[model samples]
Target: MNERDLKKLKSKKKGKERRAAQKAERARLAAAQLLVNQANAQTDPLSKFPSFINYERNGLTSSLICKKVKELEPELLQWAMNLCKENMRPLYEKSNQGWHEDEKVEEMTEDAAWYLIVLDKAANKPLAFSHFRFDMDYGDEVLYCYELQLEESCRRKGLGRFMMQVLELMAFSNQMQKVVLTVFKHNPDGMNFFKKCRYDIDETSPVDSYEETFDYCILSKMNKMKPTQKTSL
Candidate 1:
């Protein structure tokens, strides 16, 4: 080959090597940043809010730890999402949406989102989780439950009711006027569960409509505390 051709070939090789090195470096930095963010999220002081709840069902005792969404380990959050997908597949299929698409990890990181995780203390693994959010609804503070899914083995063990009671306590402590959630009309089990928990059709629920069969039913339970009034003499 001519000297000029050889030199051009070397230049091209060097350019390719440089670009490859830069790409690797960028990937390394991005991975490192992701680790740092996950660490920060997991170490947040969510334990400051109510943490432990203990209960016994059918001769077995269990405990749960409530943590804000920002305080969850990335793996734990992924587990929760997987559980949601497994337990709510019917609802997702009925709604014509992919379960994976409903996994809102980024949105769960918002300040108001929280999770109630039931853990196998010895194994340090999550058995179930409840995801909810505290936010303003029509100028009134409310707690909205997004998902509550338990392992099949954990169901019928009273864990569902226990976690819900804990959620209600958290909402009332935070001064939420009521707790609200939506249930799929086709999910009779879910509807019965919420009804047993004393949740009734919310006042703002939609009236009769042609599309009601495809719509979710909104339910709510008001806090027992009454608002204080000031009187002028």
Candidate 2:
């Protein structure tokens, strides 16, 4: 074949391959989304915790509820600890601490240590958990989130965003002025995720304090409330 014809044939082949790859990627994503939805549909009702909020996204369903860390079952608390170790090991290591070995279960069970757990009903498993409490921050009542960790398998799904949305709703329902959380500076992805969710650096953060030298970013999102309405809680 002439050089011109040969070149045209090669270009056509490349175009076909590129299209095939794109098609396969789309198919893979669609399948993943389907599995998530099926899992969500299988969630069981939380009759014990009538106040639990049920949310559905990407065909997956998760239940968000609050409980004192002490109230959690031993196995569930252990699951949470394992998740924290998996997600925060790098941050802890950066600060020269052995977080994995320090179970800290007693500290986690403090009266003020509350947990927000997202359970996958169909699989009867916890998909993610957040440790938080209502505390006075700069003279304002804010929900302070200590840890928000998801199972490794659940990371890329919309579960993080879904959990945060539920948390914010809970904050508003409880008359919290804002929701606040701290992210390690070493975890740029965590920082970026909070920012994308509309959380901004809190002016009250001790970013420049001399005594507190840990590399952390404190983020806050103000709650929207009606002037005349008050939360029953």
Candidate 3:
């Protein structure tokens, strides 16, 4: 073939390949969005796992309830917000972002927010809570755990880990690509706990550069039943 003809052929082949990749990405994202929608439609994701409703380990007995932010009682939602502030404000203040109470309140009350709350059965008080969402992140359906907070009295018990397990179960069962969370760099205990749960630094986690560094890191545990999500084209 002539030189110009060969160049044109090559260009056409590249364009075709690019178009094919774009089409495939669109399909993948559509599937992920469908899964996220189905998950969010549930009144209570925890209802599917009856055994997970109660946590009776490490000498702590608590009842677990999963509810959307809108379904939660005003007092309960307030308690969850207070616990989150109490646990996270110090870490946020220590980091570059500092602490913003108004912003935190807004996030906690968002319509998409879901809560997994642990209640002390006898005293009928909330002891711990996790705020999460079923949403598409980076083209994959993910259960993003925004906050996991426990009262000072309940920190050492196995409740936190059990809550994480519940999140994982719900995510994988609903065909989510992963259970994702962000932990502050300054919180060594949070880092260690996630590590113990077998979570790794997710591909989406930011890397430190000479010009800028991030105070928080994203961690994720993938659903082993499915192929891992592609991070790049």
Winner by lDDT: 3
lDDT of 2 by residue, 76-120 (tens): 888988888777876777863445555556556676677778888
Error of 3 at 47 (Å): 0.7
For candidate 3, the lDDT comes to 0.92
Measured against the true structure, the TM-scores of the candidates, in listed sequence, are 0.70, 0.67, 0.96
- The TM-score obtained by model 3 is 0.96
**For candidate 3, lDDT tens digit of each residue in 1-233?**
99999999999999998888888888888888999999999999999999999988777778999999999999999998888887888999999989999999999999999999999988899999999999998778999999999898988788889999999999999999999999998999999999999999998999999998999999999999989545355
Error of 1 at 12 (Å): 83
Q: Residue 40 in model 3: shift from native, Å?
A: 0.5
Cα deviation of 43 in candidate 3 (Å)? 0.5
lDDT for each residue of candidate 1 in 1-233, tens digit (9 for 90 to 100): 99999999999999998887777656644543443334234432234454446555654366677677767798988898777767787676776444455456555556667787888755667788888876655445667788888888778777888778877876675556678888887788889898888999987677766765435778998888935121111
RMSD of 3: 1.2
Reference-based lDDT, residue 204, model 2: 69
Q: Candidate 2 vs candidate 3: which has greater lDDT? A: 3
